[model samples]
Target chain A: MTEWHDAAAADALSDDEVMGLSIAGVPVALFRQEGAFFALHDLCSHGAARLSDGFVENGCVECPLHQGLVDIRSGAPCSAPITEPVRSYPVRVVGDRIEIALNR
Target chain B: MTAMPESEATYVVVGGGQAAAWIARTLRAEGFAGRLVLIGEEPHWPYERPALSKEFLRGTGSVEAITLLGAAQAGEAGIECWLGQRVTAVDRVARVVTTAGGRSVAYDTLFLATGGRARRLPGLDTVPAERVHTLRTLTESERLRGALGGAKHLLVLGGGWIGLEVAATARALGVAVTVVEAAPRLCARTMPPVVSGWLHALHEANGVRVLTGTGVAGVTGTADGIAVTLAGGGRLEADHLLLGIGIEPEVGLAAAMGLALDDGILVDAQGRTSDPRIFAAGDVARHPNAFAGASLRLESWANAQNQAIIAAKAATGGTAVYADIPWFWSDQYGVTVQMLGLPGLGTRAVARGTPEAGSGCWLMLDDTGIVAGAVAVNAARDLRVLRKLLEDGRAPLPDAWTDSATPVQRLPSRPNVGMD
Candidate 1:
């Protein structure tokens, strides 16, 4: 089953900003790059660092703890110190609210 | 100079730490289809060492969690790993390395990432081996973790990063911990006095008995516990003892090969050793560091990975220089402390945010008002921004830089006019 959860307001995050929130008890990071919003698991797959606290650049977020790069759109690890990929969610802006689809 | 055909040549990497692992992975990632061999003394594949003292000791992290390059990953990357095989000798003339198990592997190029081993205390010959411990390998960390489970008290020698991290982890496991350092303050060699004082206070607040300006005169093991005689004519008892003095670079093979050595295997900016065909990285190589303005053997995780990547690229005929600014981080008691650049070059320290509240950073500025270094505690985001600013030789005006009200990202910065 697919469940859609309202993450935040569409304008809550500016360009190149990441916001962390727990949707259905799962930590998710909402990133705004360019003009589109992408969502990925908030926790880093390699270490205990939060991906939301990382620096987003060139469509990837650099893990603040280790500088590992993770693609914000596909949630694939793009650099060393991180081999596994974080889960990505389907995000859509419904009116003024940002909604993320999570598999149950 | 002509480059060898990628598929015809063979590249060998010695050691199984993060550096060696990255070298193997990077060799394959850079489109090298040659025979890649990784030889390591330990049986296990390469894993990150930071969590061994922190999460792994606290029983929260698993071996899989810390495993950086696994067997399957190595296989996928076409890296043939010779685990549990110690490289006994390097025949520079023959272009081959011999293992203790009598296996010889020839290579067109070799990477020496033989990191280091934990420095052992001199006077612990009388103590039983099981009671006195030094954490360097996975097996040692596992043994220490097992011992801590039943231990009542842990006496950690040398209040360095490793010692303090283990102390913090032991405290989290409900074990009474005491740290004794011969230096005047904790992490005195790496951190400034203010940062060291903050760490001392943090440890004391967490119920850790920290003794500075003290040394262990002798150690004796008994049936039930271990006794440590202090240099100041005092004695202390603990269930276990961990020697966290430091690490001695594994320069045995490098020295035998007649490579230049000064504290470690001396390497150029590209990690090339005395011989152009041989390279060294990680804790074993004392390469010229642009940030410190000296040849330094950095033991941090960042340097291990980045330096290995650069060395691997250079070995494969790439022209990348290893000139990254030094960055290191340590997590203790839910607080993350990160150090960037060289703090030793700072003449003035400016505070950003409320450090007492456990969310701030200290910006170290040189005499010319340029940001020389930074120590951030739970403020990685600000440090990230500051790193870029530092790279660009930009500094925020001194007046508004220290104001906690102004956000670090919003702090306006101008190019350093005083510096050329």
Candidate 2:
């Protein structure tokens, strides 16, 4: 089952910016890579570095703590330090408001 | 009816380290029925490096744990274990290897697992066997352990992993220690900036003197003790001096054989050197990596095993490529510091948890949007997952670096000598 959860306004983040927040009591990383927006669970399975605190380039995010990289859309690590992928949520924008489905 | 003779395969291994031991084991496990000859300069067998700094130094893990071969075991495997002999040279053209003790051993296939030895500080003259020490070999470590209690001023050279570890141990023993490193930061070659900074703080907090960006001018012994002069025009009077600068590959035999050497015996993806019958692995061999598109020399315990796996398979008819991310670990001030994948600083650093406050992981990112490296402190479980991901072409999360700034995390205090 899929349900809508309120996220943030589309203009809240600048293009290529990343913001971390919590959804459904789960820590999450919100990213704006290229022109797309992505919502992923914040906690890195490998350890404590927040997914939001990682680096982003070429449509992927790298954990700053251990240098493990994850894809913003799929929450998958690209290499090293982090071996596990993070969690991803379904997202869409309604007018100026952006919402994500964390229950999917 | 006339019958022709069939040539029997033979296996020859060089080195007295763990990699050589494991390769020989793998050869037998793969069901190879061939004559095996293992030659080593040391009279003893294989040993583990992890213990060399800890219990082995403390005289707890006996020589048996460090010994690579057992007579009964090798006998059962039908292996010839050569001891107390040095390989004077190798004739690659003739497929023959000779020992200084006057014996010529021929081989169908060869494995050079020749490991590494402690690197000497150039300017510092050799110390009288008693007061000066370096802790790469079990023998030196064991001797140093006994003198640990008597050291009033300990001047340790180098700020790399070995230096930090020894400092931590000396500090734990309540011995005053001063570390001299010429680099701007400790472990400058291997770890990131933040990690080195935290270590500097950790050692200083423990009352150890960590002088970075400083060089040791020279060391001369007087009637009182050894005088350690610094580059910045200072002097350190110490009872004992321990130099842990680094290690160098033991490639004397390889060079004598003229096996197309660079910094080490150069090998291809399959660990095959210029002489096809001769292959090298572990710290002694510089092999090409398809992933990095360059030749690399690896000295970590993990690297040794991984390289040995490749050499063994190739020696047994498997031609797998030798390529994997380099990883290394060290324990300092009770932190299990593990580095996965090689990384250089690229302006992006993410701090998970609080390393300064104690406990967390660090991720260093590069411009390519891939994780160049990941560092974990006191987190081995997570490192495994991260290690696996990197191996599978996966990187960690992409974002800014962070930490739990609100509160400090309390960790289980570590034993003084527990880290490797």
Candidate 3:
């Protein structure tokens, strides 16, 4: 089962920016790129680092701790030293608020 | 030696650390269907070493958290691992590696990613093993963590990255720490003098008594603690002592094979050793670095993974050169310190902001105004931009970079359109 949880204000993040927040007590990283919103688990799949603290470039987010690249839209690892994919969630902006669908 | 078909060729990687693990993974990813064998002396799977002195030492990270390649992943990737086995000899002519257990594995291509071992201070044989520690492996880190759990005062010899990180972790655990370094400044070998001063201040501010320009004359274990005599005739006592001088590359097998070695096994831009069929990477391979303008054997986590990937690709019929700008980072006391390129090659140091103020970067420019290196403290975002500028051989005017009104991402650089 999946439930949509309100994450933040639609205007809270600028284009090509990422913000980390908690929904249902689970850490989630929300990114806005080219006016589209994408969300993934906040933690890096390889190390104990927050992906939100990483740099977003191209179509991927670079892990600040190890420089591993993870695809933003799909949460798939795009580079070496990272083989596992981070969990991505469905995000949508509704009524001036961004909501993420999380499977509990 | 007989030439085997590509599908039947056996590739043997001797090492169980980051480099070896990556080599195996990359080989499989590159669709090398031949036999792959990975031999590592450590019993555990391949894992990153950065957390040994930080999270692992603080008991906040687990073995599972640091593991890079787990058993399930390795098994699925068709990698054969010989754990707890040390390579005793390498027959270059025969293309076979003999382990200490008398198991010999013949290979079409051999990779030496032996990495290194912690350099121990001489003349400490008299001290009890329980009181003195040197962290290089998971077992050593875990042992030291257990000791730190009950310790009140910890004495650290050598104020390099490992020593300082362990000291910081100990302080975080409410233990008093003292660090002694023979150099004039902390991390003097790699860091600039100004950055060394900043690290000294950071440690002192964190309640760590840092003794630069100091050396250890002797160490003796007492009934309840360890006593260290300074080279200048000063004495200090502590519940435990950690030696974090540096690492010595494991080059015995390489040397026995008569492979060219300078400080470490000499490798080309493709991570190819003296022999055509054998390759070396990671902390054990001294390869030519374009960024450093010299042959360097980097021990950072980035080098291990990057170089290994390059070696794996080159070994599997791919043309990839290992020429990435040398990058390294350290986390201490809530601060993330990152370095790109060779800061030692800089003639002028340009400050973007006050790094000591928590978030800033020091751009190291050469005499020709090229960005030779950079040191970023809690400014990883800027460091990413600086890495690109360094790679492009581009540099913004010092005034433009230093100006706080301009963002780093928007900094303009002189294009090298026609420059040779």
Candidate 4:
């Protein structure tokens, strides 16, 4: 069963901006880029650093700790220092609200 | 340059450390279908070395936890690893390497990533004693970890990265630690004065006595413990003494081959040594860095992996240049300190965080107003953003640079006008 949770209001994050959100005690990162919203696990796969604090560039989030890059849409690691991919959440925007499907 | 062999020639890499593993992995990943061989001196697989001083020393993990390229992975990658085999000679002229195991292997391309050995204190016989140690391999770290368990007090003879790290680990283990540095400040060669002061304060706050401007004249074993005699006519005692001074490049095989070497094997930007057929990387290779405008040999883990990849690709007919800005990290007392780029001489250091706060970022800008380098203490996010600005030669607003409330990304990165 899929657990749908409202992580944040869609307008809270501007384009190319990232914010940290807690959905049902799961640390999640919300990223808005190119007028679209995406979500992924906030914790970096390489180290215990928050992905929300990472820099968003070229549709990828470079982990602040160690500079590992993860694709915002696919949660796939696109650079060195990180090999494992983060768990990406399916997101949908409904009436200025961001909904994430936590496949719990 | 030796001609490519008619038969299937093997891509041979000496030294089974991080650099060799990356070289082999990259060769196969880049579609080099030739035979691949890795000659390692250690019996175990290639593992990450930084953890030897951090998590592994703290008893939080085992050797298996830090293994980078295990046997199974090597088999899957079709790499023939000669573990515990030492290469005695590299015949660069004939394109063959002789191993201590009485075997000679010919290679179409060769990578000499013969990293380095820990620099021991001069005139010190570092036998397998419980009281004296120098960490360079897994065996050393394991022994030091075991010694830490029964040790009451520890004396570290250097204030470099390894020494400070081991001091922090010992302090965490409830071992009374004293770090004696010959320099006036901690990490004098690498760190800025502010960062050095910060590390000094960090160690002192955590019960580690940091004695600066003190040199160890001689070390002698006492009846029950080790005694360190200071050059200034003083003595200190400890259950164990560790020497974390520095490393000497393992250039024996390369030097024997008569390849060009000053402090290390000289390599070009493509990681090519003086000989076209042989390439070098990691601590053993001193190559020109475009950023620093000089040749340097970096001993960091990132350089080991990245430079080896470039060398591997170059061996396989790729044009990748190994000129990335150097980056390194050290973990001590729960603080992750990191550095990127070259803080050239004569640059001014500007702190982005409060110096008194003990955790902030320090930026070194060249006289031309170009951001040259950065050192971050627990402010990795800011460092990441600042790294880009440094790479782009952009300068941040002075008011916002030091303000912690202002996000680093929000600071404009357009190159500072008239600074070029």
Candidate 3: tens digits of C-alpha lDDT, residues B1-420: 336677899999999999999999999999999999999999999888999999988998999888877899889998999999999988777778899999998899999999999998778888888998999999999999999999999999999999999999999999999999999999988887778888999999999999999978889989998999998998999999999999999998888889999999999999999898999999999999986778998999999999999999999888889999999999999999999888766667888889987789888776776667889998887888777676776666666888867867687777522223
The docking category that best describes candidate 4 is medium
Each candidate's lDDT (Cα)?
0.89, 0.73, 0.90, 0.85
**TM-score of each candidate structure, all chains considered together:** 0.95, 0.73, 0.93, 0.94
* DockQ, prediction 4: 0.69
Candidate 1 residue B85 Cα shift, in angstroms, is 1.2
Q: What is the DockQ of candidate 3?
A: 0.62
iRMSD for every model: 0.7, 9.1, 1.3, 1.5
- Please give the clash total of every predicted structure, in order: 0, 39, 0, 0
Give the DockQ-based CAPRI class for model 1.
Answer: high
Candidate 1 per-residue C-alpha lDDT over B1-420 given as tens digits, one digit per residue, 9 for 90 to 100: 336687989899999999999999898888889899999999988988998888887788888878878988888888999999999999998999999999999989999999999998776777888898898888989999999999999999999999999999999999999999999999988787778889999999999999999977889997888999998999999999999999999999999999999999999999999999899999999989876678888999999999999999998878999988899999999999999988757777788886545888888777777767888999998888788776676767666678768767688888854553
Off by over 4 Å in 1: A1-3, B1-4, B416-420
Residue pairs in candidate 4 whose N, alpha carbon or C atoms collide under 3 angstroms: none
User: What TM-score should be assigned to candidate 1?
Assistant: 0.95
Off-target runs (Cα >4 Å) in candidate 2 are A1-104, B1-7, B66-68, B345-347, B400-420
How high is the lDDT of residue B107 in model 2? 78
Error of 2 at B329 (Å): 1.0
List the lowest-lDDT window of 10 residues for candidate 4 chain B. Answer: B1-10
Better of 2 and 4 by TM-score: 4
